[model samples]
Target chain A: MTSVVAQQIPYDSAAPYRSLSLNTATTKRWTLAEAVDGAARAGLGAIGLWRDRVDEVGATTAAKIVADAGLRVSSLCRGGFLTGREHGPAALDDNRRAIDDAATLRTRELVMVMGGIPDRDLAGARARVEERLALLVPYAAERGVRLALEPLHPMFCADRAVISTLAQALSMAEPHPSETVGVVVDTFHLWWDPTLADQIAQAGAAGRISSYQVCDWLNPMAPDPLLSRGMMGDGVIDFAAIGRWVRDAGYRGDVEVEIFNATVWSSDGHEVIETMKRRYRELVLPSLVG
Target chain B: MTSVVAQQIPYDSAAPYRSLSLNTATTKRWTLAEAVDGAARAGLGAIGLWRDRVDEVGATTAAKIVADAGLRVSSLCRGGFLTGREHGPAALDDNRRAIDDAATLRTRELVMVMGGIPDRDLAGARARVEERLALLVPYAAERGVRLALEPLHPMFCADRAVISTLAQALSMAEPHPSETVGVVVDTFHLWWDPTLADQIAQAGAAGRISSYQVCDWLNPMAPDPLLSRGMMGDGVIDFAAIGRWVRDAGYRGDVEVEIFNATVWSSDGHEVIETMKRRYRELVLPSLVG
Candidate 1:
């Protein structure tokens, strides 16, 4: 992967604050406190919090930890499994709790991954998601949180999220106010989409893009598809193109680096953050925030 | 998996000649002649040929064996790795040879799997696929063979086929005559598409459907994603729904079951065919050919 870290990059160094954020999942080995410290040490503008990490230190303490580190909470990792039939009530209740956590963490964006189908009824599951999202939308809005619908890659259509395109997320969010319901544009999940350019433009124009998650789609995907995301530039993603699209859409938000690869997780968390900055500056930010 | 096979099925058995087909990949342990004989013995109307098996016995004898068994060649497995710059000339030559073989086999359909992008340029790779297909159109037309564009699942967009949607396939085929250029409707690859119903209708209305391939998508996909395909009804694909879509679209064509699962490949080839027939009858044909 270091091969992608070339000898001569266009930019030798990034600015002190490039609106860069570190997602907790990228540093699997680090605790919430440690991740916050690492982000601050790396001079990141923000940090994306995973609920699991927040729960470990309690939401209030986690918020304090990030605030003390002087890093903004870019987004909450997740808050949606609304497609479950038997777990319907539990899922709804948990999402409310997640909204509470997001509110406590002081992050407006609560990334939602609509659950996959339990049975083969894809359309049915999707309808349930829509219905469930309607129920959660009001509650989330009450908490001043935006339930950011994350359109996972089509690969995860059956197991993770039935919603598989930025357009679908945008359409679902269309009924609600953009501030209450918005979309996440994750590079790993959306880079393969044929209509990505148009969809990115649409997302931007509609003022519905809530989160911008950066992670490259590994070419020879890891055995476990979930952990297949690589550090930016380590995979064959044209980050510059996608970054430019996001940038042109009039979004000046925190770009969260969220690598899910085992190798990235096993590496030194601090070093990974530095590498993330270098790669983001070298590849994506050049077109994005240049 | 047996849980899917209810004792009380809608149909006790399939019709004698149901236009059912068996792709060689399903019975990976079997040779071309074995697959043909197995398909014939199972009362299938056709058999989908893989180039590897055809190469094993040579195309002439392979064609003779299939003809001798009184089974039609449904379609050729593939012939379109036209994205490689280094292998561009060779890929075109090999595709022409595949067209020749398809003609010799007396099947009009040569399933073209548009190759993956070697770099991060998805748009560039897709353009090349469209361009390379243009070069093969006349050659295929002369031999009465149609280069059937197979839109692989988006998951394989990087390593397998860049054409990941039926709409994309149809767009690529729009510039060419339907008789010489066509689209493939594979349930496993296309079941996740939100616009599948409309695309199927479009493909059918345009008479662009060259093949209808079937295989279930396993939920907890296998370690080797390529070998993760499951038997019909054993996975989460709503075959009945897709079948009706194709049927309503006016595609009165052979239904080929092309699985690439290690378990299916390791199992008894004849038994797998029997299971495929039963599943097709119970799950797909109930709405498809009923």
Candidate 2:
């Protein structure tokens, strides 16, 4: 892997793949260094880092490696799970740490997967998220780390994340400054929303879109749809239409390709990067503005 | 099945199970006559009829059996796949026939599972549903049959129904008189909605809640979550919470038990009804008006 990494081609930020960023979760098996080098080799401008991968090498070292490789860290994978009752204080502390890490990595966005309901109280769980979010706003703003609320698909609302819509995420982000609080527009989770176009426009008008992540939603979703995300154009989603919505919204940020399928993970890391680049070009690049 | 029909216990309309109805899909293998008998034997006053079950014995014959068995048809299972562009006229004609069947069966509500996006044009498909619905309104009104739009869970947005929220269904119903066009509030399809309480209130205030179907959403969903619905108390849904919303919204309608899992269906039909009654009494009935 290191041999492959040393000989890798460096990404050109001013080229056609300028905005393409590889989210580490897309190739879950790669080490942080390998991912940075792989993204650079694929001519991808940036990479989205998951905390566990960053934690493996420590945030300070991970940041240096990416910077040395001439690649930007587009966004940290996540930092919010503020729905716990007994673990509320602990959850807040952990999120504070995530914010600190994002600051160190020099990434503006920290994606937040608001945790699921601890009990049967979905309303209460969401309320707690709002309460904790208010508390963290100042801390995040000071570090220039925007908390990007991600509304997972409704299927995970029971035991995963209660935030299930872009509108809900926007509402959660409304009171804070856009620089400190923003939303992630992930196609895999939100493409089914009937009001998607309107909401994307709203997110854009408010300057709250912190990141744009791309992945396909497979039908007959894997036993766990959580891992069913495929490469763009592999499923029923119209990436072109959704991509146009994100672009028209005035978002000139990194467009990350994030997938979680088991099959995609089993393939050689380099092969996966090649496929990701192809899918991004054919299915997504045409819809994005340079 | 016919032999059991004669010895079946008669349902008492004034009893606790007066508003309890059995959707034939719950006991998928049961014939129309058997379902009528099973519901009556279980002291359930009504049964929901699927078109195929009604077609098994002809709608007229099915209607007579339920009437003779002292049971009411709470609703006719379907009548709306109006999303097909090329088959627009055929879809409308089929829905017209379904309306006639609902009227013939003496059930006021005909549940409409609006078809999914025909192509990549979701907005256009939904527009087609609204257009065809306008054309069907007069005919449905003449027969005193209400077209009840059912918003299936978002998972089914691609291949099943594009209507994925109660609010969307209500919006579609807004143009017509409540008695002619209404919506079905099925727990399995809507348990994850954050604005449920408000929407239920809106549905009731507008007199647009045509039916209330109960079925729990499984967590580690079966291969097909479409058929993963469980008996009440078997899944994570807070039925007590959702049921209260429906009751407070001024709805005094049939509470239909509609399960679709293979495990439930493979059980003895009578045994399934017995379990359904027990679960309903424990998990859902208490939430309704005493």
Candidate 3:
């Protein structure tokens, strides 16, 4: 017979740090240096640099400018597209350059978009991707740059990526247990995953969970092969739940907001960043904290 | 030593009966009786019925008409929206009615659309759905109406269905070990599935594989939600491969063509059915036969 003390736990009203990481595609209108400057001025935490942007500004100069702006590099945008004959030598060479770029930028991860079928042969394409990944893993590991395999949405399965689920990504990375090979779970691609909770947990257990990207899938009237993504909170993604799940899975990484909306990109970049930050603080952070 | 012989299989090179099943939605412009008439006239082996269409012209009458027309009932259109107070009761009642309707029609399967959040609680909504499903299982089992949990696309996850992945649906059906509870693996919903092959195999092994619905996911924009679906070979689904896989998995069910497109519907329903038949003959049936 113990008397229970009535004590109310104080609610944490303050939100988590709304670290703004601008995926350079958000401001494809701006150059790499310009994007870096814009991000710095906007009080952003980091910037995800793309290959084309680096090529445009020259890798060394882009690296220097980013360092100068006092901005952390979130990730290097992509280094995998193992599908076409054009993809063979060209993709490998491009990936090698991307690895070098990631090392130069001091980026934590090099996002890999595993290309899908070239000859409508899915199994063959997947095999080729695995072979390429096996070859690239050692090189990436030696460079101290983790290769984050980004599983594209199944809509992109025909021409973009055969690895269409986070579980599949984890499976792909299982053979290479090294931290060098990891998986990037983007909400746009994986929010629909029924086994999301289990897969995320599995990724955490394996120490292969690299980056957590947030985006909403727009309910388009017609399917556009490219450039039709929703702004976070505007669509039907349980971001807060996902954020909490990922955090619980021991992902102490930055929650990178990566929206690939043509509509949002067409508008003011500054406004979009501010709106995203507000949403991140209000909608996403509370769930994670609780 | 195995010798490669160029032997021509005497099956109709111009027409394939195996790939042809009429989904009533393709002829939404026509009444249920008319659809049955058209299906029988086209010499289609199977036909999928919808609850709304059945309701329009009483379930008993629809059943009689289908039976009179001499067509195999592939599946009955839907029976699950397990969420919300008002909607939940309505949904359960509706599902019971649908089960009865399916049974009356002598349909092999009753497809279930697992409804999304009553309000905005995705996790809670999902739990509610599972609870309701558990309750409905025995009822469905008793009636000999196999409940095929159809996982809707993620875009429909907000308002239409909480169960947006085939794996989730399969998991829900896992508890019920009998063939009474199963899943309908629709290409529109599951083509994007990362673990599609594995899940299909799992569904087959569990004896939960009930029906296979086909509709191409169109690339172009459309205005209506219900009538924007692509016809076979008109969009980007690997039907041949999927059909082969389904056949290999021992799915001896109807390859039902269920296209919900305004363009096709506005055109002659007979022509639409004919085009689907042609595509089935040329592209789909060959893959299954192989």
Candidate 4:
């Protein structure tokens, strides 16, 4: 633990480092070793992983790579999508494997994107999420991994995730212990919520915010909603206000930068990392610390 | 009151038409007279007018057109857009004119789409909406017009309306009386809300639910979010669930079919109206009465 803390050099000692984690999605082209080394080289304290990237190089080797790099695995990308009637068994088995992967990667949080409305039944899809999440709780707890329910933007309710607010995620997570089940506070998905500040506070008070992801919701959302996430300062989200709320909520954890945009992906990975660092320092870091 | 009720032919006497209204936007290319005739010919009891269409023939002539066709003007399309610092006077003047037009058309509800983020300050923009809304309340009340605050979908927070939920709109309308200040529960904008049922009930109890609009939210939202709205059954929205909540909230107002998809707009106006009627009958009407 001492050595791990020693290796994370503060990007600026004057301000010190608030836990900064780089989600691999921000640099989509990077391999596991590249992302781990890149995050470590940039003085970041942690890295968030995607399942496909972990599967590329088996979870064991991926875990060793991150561990050897002296970086913590802040979170694993996803584990839910458990809303299909015909696909339930396979999805549950896949989520179980994701839980094992999270444990192997040395991360407590496994992000869960409850699947979209399977057929035209939004209510049923959401109900399935609650039911499936309950089934996974014991397995996730046994593996020492917390299922982090992520409420995606409402725009994605039909195709991506039906859980569309932190409040909904928290309600779903309420039945379980906070240590076994948690919620993710992703700025891009939730910045537009009117009750955002209060919800963030509630999540904090409940100790349920397992991950704090930062990305911007770009204006005139991309033709494809999936590619509409922008870098921190590129969109209209008021990060300072939201960041302050997260910090005040008692979240002393990794602030992961997770962006998904074609333009961001097409740029040089190293340059993208640099821009993320600069923007975090300029726009988000102060709010968390101030 | 007796004459008004006598003129409204129930689309189906068995069903007891629950204030069926057509927003001119659904038939985008139609002139005010054409839309009025189309709405009346189809036995729709009311019409919701857009300012541009009303301005085309002047409000007095537009009012005469609806009256001649024995249709009530359910609502004027909009009045707010008051987020700009330099455009205050122009916005106020326009809203005042809209109030006059609502009176001229014998409708109490004048829908307001409070403008989106002007510059980068979302809090400031929202504050401006509150301030501007306060200024318009007395003027609206004097004209016997209710400023119906319509919450646009969160997807439109950047370019269109920033008030993104019924809760936010209700909070904004709280300072004024329900008679002069009310809220709109448009299914396309609000079907995704988890607390929707409660909010609708709250609005109903307060007598602040001025209007209820229906349109489906297409899966692959249109390239332009404005054109993403489809006819009721054509998309993935659970109309029955939302329609039930609207009815339970005591909203006996027009369920305005206000779709804006490019395909719907480009089709024959009369055919589009037929599809709207059929979809409403099949998907939305049942929930309201059942």
Clashing pairs in 3: A222-B221
Poorly placed runs, candidate 2 (over 4 Å): A1-14, B1-14
Error of 3 at A212 (Å): 1.5
In the range B1-290, model 1's lDDT, one tens digit per residue, is 00110011122233634578899989988999899899988888888999999999888899899989988888987899898756478889999889888888888888999889889989989888878889989888778888899998888999999888899899999999988899999988889888799999999999888888888999989988888789999899999899889888888778889999988877899899889988887788777755
Where does candidate 1 chain A have its weakest 10-residue lDDT segment?
Answer: A1-10
Candidate 3, lDDT over the whole model = 0.76
What overall lDDT goes with each candidate model?
0.86, 0.85, 0.76, 0.86
Docking class of 2: acceptable
Interface RMSD, all candidates in order, equals: 0.9, 1.6, 3.6, 1.3
Query: Order of candidates by DockQ, top first?
Result: 4, 1, 2, 3
What's the CA error at residue B273 for candidate 1, in Å?
1.0
Model 2 pairs whose backbones collide: none
A1-290: candidate 2 lDDT, tens digit per residue? 00111111222334867678999998899999999999998887889999999999999999999989888888998887888886578889999999989888888888999888767677889998999999999888888788999999998887778899999999989999987899999988888888899999999999999899999877657876788899887887888889889878888788898999999999988898888888888888777753
Q: If both were scored by DockQ, which would come out higher, candidate 1 or candidate 3?
A: 1
Task: Compute the interface RMSD for candidate 2.
Answer: 1.6
Q: By DockQ thresholds, what CAPRI class is model 1?
A: medium
Stretches off by above 4 angstroms in model 3 are A1-19, A85-87, A217-228, A286-290, B1-19, B85-87, B118-120, B217-229, B286-290
Candidate 3 global TM-score: 0.87
Rank candidates by lDDT, best first: 4, 1, 2, 3
Please identify model 1 stretches exceeding 4 Å from their true place.
Answer: A1-16, B1-17
lDDT tens digits by residue: candidate 3, B1-290: 11111111233435466336798888888888889888888988778888888899888888788888877788888888777755467778878888888877887588888776645457778888788888888777777788888888765776678788777888888888546788888887777665678878878888788888888766442544455478877776788888777767767667788888878889888898889888887667876667
